[model samples]
Target: MSTTFWIILAGAIATYLTRVGGHLVISRFENIHPRVEAGLNAVPAAVLTTLVAPAVLGAGPAEWAALVVTALVSLRGGLMSMFLAGAAVLIIARQFVG
Candidate 1:
């Protein structure tokens, strides 16, 4: 409706295209290199660690608790599940622990 809204919408579209574009290009390959597949599989854990490191550096008890739960969940779950579990723990703990 506004200039800012249009900018945000355009950014969202561009981001989505960029994210999918990589997969589209990669999917054309009949066989992926093992090293490439390993690198791709590592991306999620690498992303998680980078996101966690800064927060953990200056975090309190609630944040630490959530991070621990997230790490534990990560061993058995996907990124979204671990994130949601961590968020829920953080929110609930913050209400009391913080």
Candidate 2:
């Protein structure tokens, strides 16, 4: 195999092992404390914020407007709705602003 193939194979194996290891470790815990459970529940949101913050901070007015629309729509709708609303707003805003 080429070096690229070997690198991809190694990455796949590493990703699989980490996923399985996390599942195994988590499954062993019979009863999680309330605080720990709450923290775990917040992890997804925290991760999403961390991933999005930098882009949002560096974005232009149109992007910021889209984000505002996204937040408003998110309050009254599900994830898909929020995403669509944000995308539509961004597209429209970009046409006018950019």
Candidate 3:
């Protein structure tokens, strides 16, 4: 309808096609190469570090506390639980730190 709308629609379609194309290509391979598999396995951590590293540089005590809680919770809890715990700690810590 609008230029912004068309741009967003184009982006969405491109993202979906890229994802499906990757899956289709991977599925065609009977056995993945060890180096390729290792690179793929590292994707999650690399993505996570990219997301967190910039924030870490400017984070304050509340953020640090939340990060510590999140890390500790992640060791024993599922993703949802760890997220909730970290969110709760961040909220609580902000009250005092602020």
C-alpha root-mean-square deviation, each candidate: 3.8, 2.5, 2.0
**Best-first order by TM-score:** 3, 2, 1
Q: lDDT tens digits, residues 1-98, model 3?
A: 99999999999999999889878989899999999999989988999899999998899999999999999999999999999999999999999997
List model 1 lDDT by residue over 1-98, tens digit each.
Answer: 99999999999999999899988988899898999889989999898789868879999999999989998999999999999999999999999987
TM-score of each: 0.58, 0.75, 0.82
Clashing pairs in 1: none
Q: Candidates ranked by lDDT, best first?
A: 3, 1, 2
Clashes of 3: 0
Query: Residue 88: error of model 1 in Å?
Result: 6.6
* Model 3 TM-score (2 dp): 0.82
TM-score of 2: 0.75
Choose 1 or 3, whichever is better by TM-score: 3
lDDT at position 72, candidate 1? 100
Best by lDDT: 3
